[model samples]
Each structure stands twice: as structure tokens, then as C-alpha cells.
Target: MTGVPASAAGGTGRTVPRGKLGTAAVNQASLWNIANILTMVRLVLVPAFVVLLLQDGGHDPVWRAWAWAAFAVAMITDVFDGHLARAYNLVTDFGKIADPIADKAIMAAGLICLSSLGDLPWWVTGVILFRELGITLMRFWVIRHGVIPASRGGKMKTLAQGTAVGMYVLVLTGPLATFRFWVMTVAVVLTVVTGLDYVRQAVVLRRRGLAAERADAAAKAGQRA
Candidate 1:
């Protein structure tokens, strides 16, 4: 309701319903917005977070706490940005492009730092990083086609990952250490499973997109002929 911009009819500059804006109009929307600002903040936090995370090899509890706080703040921006984008219909091309980059950067940096400190298994880091980067590439590959909203499994994987990373960053001991291991295991499993599913979905979408393009082309040829 509020904060909704007046929609145009397919870039015609004529007012129209927001939901009925044509593809060209939507694509022409401006890059700067509230959501994108949050995304940019996340990007700025990446190097700072990695620095804090790796300091003193993550052995100093005081510094580790600072790193955890930084990571938490970064993740919080992620949550709010997406929410604000969807709630206010403030989504834009720049937000779509920059948002995932920030997510992957922060998460990958954290995972790598943890592995470097010998806090987590390298194999786990390798697998999750592979999946994260692969899926991100897939998203860009299909950027001209359409977007894939995060699936339920992807959401679960994020929760598992965040929880596990928090545990590792906080350096919980004893019983909690065992619990974190199990949580991370779940995260890894979800990571792999959802990753494979994403690949399957991307393939299907690409095929459909190609088919539609071919059909559209043939239609134009027939009309011209």
C-alpha cells in the first residue's frame, strides 16, 4: 500500500497497476533503493568480518566474540534486506545481483577462516563452498531467464549453516560441541541435497526458456512470411 511507486504501462509512462507492469518496465527500474543499501552494507562487512574472524587464529575468546558479533550483524542485514525488498516491492536489478554476492562472500569467508583455524574439517568447508559457488553461478547463468526463489531446503540449509557457524565461532565446549557437530552435519547434508536439486531446477528452467524463445522466433517468422 504505502511506499508503492506509481507503475507505468510497459515503459509507456502511463500509470498502471503495480502488479500488471510489463516486463520492460520492471527491468528498467532504478538500482538504488532501501533494500540495495542494506545489501551494500553486507558487502562492506565482508572483509571486516573475515579479518575479525581470523584474528589470533580465532583463539582469543575476546576477539572471537567480536568476530561472532560482526558475522551476526552481517547475517542480520541479509534477513532484513530480503524482507524489505519483498514487503515494499523495492526489488531491483542491482539488489538481485549484489545480494547473493555478499551472502556468498561473508559465508565463504567465515567457513574458510574456521577451516584455517583448524576449527572445522576442511572437507566440510570444501563441499559447502563448492555448492555455494556452483549455485551462485547457476543463478547468474539464468539471470536473463528468471529468478529462483530460495527453496524450502535452501532455507533449512541456511539455518543449519548459521547455527553451526555460530557454534563454531562462539567456541562452545563439551556437550554443546557435540551438538554443533550434529548441526553442522545436517547443514552439510542439506547443502549437498539442495545443491543437486538446484542444478536440476536450473536445467529445467533453461530448457523451458530455450523452448519458449524458439517458439517466439518461429511465430515471428510465420507472421513475416
Candidate 2:
């Protein structure tokens, strides 16, 4: 029938494909955007930082100091990537997912390494790690429900932890001998409090389920009408 129409059945079936070369180019550019590249760089540096910290069985103060410096640089990158993503309009799903993962990995590595050195107590590290792990699991469980944006307290907690870690490292360098203990004590308090705050927020969100429920109800109503 009419030469078996070019697109009938399997004859080339060229129906002006949905994706164009230009669209593909845009997607590739987005994938390699500045924010995502920075995140990847952070991820790559984590293992190196860990290696530096663990290389010398905790004896050499010089190695310890350098390790601390590496950790600090990595943490700074953590802050920079987020700020750049937002300011330059380069935020992406990839950044959102990997940024926190990178933070947790670096923190966990530091805590574990320092704990092994007796600079940090096991119980203290245990508490912090437990909170971090617990909250992360809770987030995943409730991810389908709704987004739970970060609180001001959470941000404060991060700042406190970073400051405490830096100070603790400096103490190892023999600079702030007298005040180091006090600094760490304050850091521990902030960490525990912030962790509890996150748990409380998660519980509240679970009880309400307001955002997800509202969206679902709206969709059903539209379908019926």
C-alpha cells in the first residue's frame, strides 16, 4: 500500500526522534558543570586525607599536623562547593546527593583516626558516629515523604564540629595546651545537642506527613474532576 510507507512497521521508523544533538550537548554540559566537578574533586581527596592521617601510627606530630591541614582543606572545599552551586545557579541532584556523603566520610575518618590515637575518647566518638548514622538512615526512610530542610541549629553544629576538630588538631601540635580540653568539651556538647535536634525534627515530620499527603490529595482531586 503506497510503497509500504517509510515509517510503517520497521522501515527506518524515523519519526523525528525526541532528543536532538543540541539537547544532548546541553545535558553533557550540565553533567560536567562546575559544582559537580568540585564535588567529585572533594570525593577524590577524601581517601588521600585518610591515608595521610593513618600512615604514621600516631607518633609523629608533624604528620599529624599535615593530616589536620589536609582535613581542613577538604572541609573548606565542602563549604565552597555548596556556596558556589547556589550563587552561580549550578545546583544539581548529583551535588545534593554527594555533598553530605563527602562530609560524613571525612568526619568519620577523622574521628576514627583520632580516637585510635587516644586524642579523642571512644565514647565521645561513638556518640557522634551513632547520631550521624542514625539520622542518615532516618532521612532515607522518610525521603519519599518529603524534604526536611536543614535547620539553623544544624548549621551551627557543623561550625562547632569543624572548629573543635581544628582546635584538637592544633593541640596535638603543642600550641594550645591549656585550653584544648575545654574546646573539645564544648564541641562535644554542641554535637550531641544538634544530633538530638535532628532526631526530634524527623519524628515531627513522620507524625504529620503533611507535605506528602497534601500533594497526593491534590493529585487525586484533579484526576476525579
Question: How much does candidate 2 score in TM-score?
Answer: 0.80
Local accuracy of candidate 1 as per-residue lDDT tens digits, 1-225: 422344423455556655555554555654567788889989998888877877876688878888888889888888999999999898887887799889888889889989989999999999999999889889889967777779999989998898788789886889999999999999999999999999988998889899999999999999999
Q: How many backbone clashes does candidate 1 have?
A: 0
lDDT of 2 by residue, 46-153 (tens): 788767766667656677677788878878888888888899888777888898998888888878877887878888789878888888898987777666787887
Whole-model lDDT, model 1:
0.85
- The C-alpha lDDT values of all candidates are 0.85, 0.75
Give the best candidate by lDDT.
1
Name every residue pair that clashes in candidate 2. Answer: none
**TM-score of each prediction:** 0.80, 0.80
Q: Model 1, which residues run further than 4 Å from truth?
A: 1-33
- Judged by lDDT against the true structure, how good is candidate 2? 0.75
